[model samples]
Target: MVAVRTARTLGLALALCFFSGAFAGVGTAQEKKAEKAKSKLKISVPQDDAELQIEGKATKPTGTVREFETPDLEVNKAYEYTFSVTWRPNNYTTLTRTKSVEFKGGTADINVDLTKADPKAPDKAVIRWVPTPDDVVEEMLKLGSVKEGDVVYEPGPGDARMLIAAVKKGAKKGVGIEIDAKKAAEATENVKKAKLDEKIKIIEGDALKQGDYSEATVVLLYMGNEFNALLRPILEKQLKPGTRIVSHRFTMGDWAPDKTVPVKGADGDEYMLHLWTVKEKK
Candidate 1:
């Protein structure tokens, strides 16, 4: 009877061991399946020194490529992946490029070439040329309080109409920085036609690199939000106290406007104007 009981007990222990091993194997398989469901992104940069950010989170690069792993995603659903790279090439200005791509659940690759992504390229205007309506321009100048002895400056000036009007309104000088050569010539010709060439000057260059707006008593902008953001640092650093910045239909990011006004353009469209005044640096 004792021998028979020992055999039964040993048999029961072996059965329990087998089931435990099987459950452990199942758990391992589930873990592998969970890992397979994750999404992976591979980014390739032109240089190793470039700063990379994925979804606003800073990522460290391994050589020229960085492999980023994300949580599990729905197989058929598309997701937007955004990344930005900041790098300064030898003898060139520092440039930051942001790109977004729609990606499905899988391994994805992105290549960033800084040389081709330069925003200051002569032919590559960041913002399209949209002329502010005559009535809107008048309102913008008035909102900026441009008057005699004021040096009015416009960046990405579509035409010199705003500057001509500013000078005619008793501004001492008007300066326009235009990126496109053709537009610059057209604006210069327009100034000559208005007989204000002596008071107004149109510069053919990239507005982002101009760096000098210290003389501007009133700055006028009709650029988009992105362009305004890129110019904000330069404006704050160079513009003097009491200088007024008037933007038509766009505001600098996070920098609240001192005053905002709404005007009806002659085209029967309502336009918004934002004004920011530079305060004395404490």
Candidate 2:
């Protein structure tokens, strides 16, 4: 009986001793580990009552981490954090932003709103009209020596011609005068050969040179392009009321003529003839 019981009892006693020593060492290690872990997570909050949260891949374990574990440590392995704070306004603006921020490491969006409207929006801008100078017109009106019954004749090309035509039309019944183009004179001569040259006087002089023609109702013009613009200011200043101006070929600078007549040429194409009048001061 003694021989059969000896081996079995001895083996059982040795196994029990090994297990007890292992358990004692494990308990001592657990106490030391807990103390270290408490010091590492020094998560103290400020005076402001803000929410604190944790986020990210480490915090929210997924994929292969589902079954992962440390043989010694019994702590949660995930890590994440979040906080709540007041957002500051920019510059002197009344705009303010408020947000609850997450600890995720990526782009975040913040929205802002204004407490009041922008002060600069109410400012008014100055606007001005850019027309012919008043002095220029005044100078023109001062030259109103020509009476309503005085003769006016068209001269030169371009705007000068237009003014001449306009003045002729606006002149008194027997006052306005017009000189047709050279081509018009030929046409007139073909129709009626007798006294055609006398009726349409082709004066070969630069009308720009100031002179006296009291008998004329208005001066008609069909002069060259360059001369027309050059002579405009002079004509406006010196032209008398009864003495009108008409131009056919070119236009004066920024001048709105009183009338426009469309003439059909030999080719059947239409050309616009402008007429401008010097009105009496209102």
- The 0-to-1 C-alpha lDDT of every candidate, in the order given, reads 0.72, 0.32
Quote model 2's TM-score. 0.31
Question: Estimated TM-score per prediction?
Answer: 0.60, 0.31
Off by over 4 Å in 1: 1-41, 44-125
For candidate 1, the per-residue lDDT at 241 reads 99
* Runs in model 2 lying further than 4 Å from the true structure: 1-152, 156-193, 196-203, 210-215, 242-244
lDDT of 1 by residue, 1-282 (tens): 111111121121211111112101122344345433344456777578877765565655445765655544434345565567766543323556776655554444434343344444321225667888888999998999999999999997777889998999999999999977889999999999999988998999988886389999999998777677778878999999999999998899999999999998778889999999999999
lDDT of 2 by residue, 1-282 (tens): 112211122121211111122101132454346521110111222212222222111212222111111112222222122211211122211111122221211212112111222233211111111112223222222232334454444442211222222233343322212122453344344323432232333343334443334455554444333445555665666665534454444467676666655555555555445566665534
Locate the minimum summed-lDDT window of 10 residues in model 1: 15-24
Clash pairs (backbone) in predicted model 1 = none
Best by lDDT: 1
Q: What's the residue-level lDDT of 47 in candidate 2? A: 18
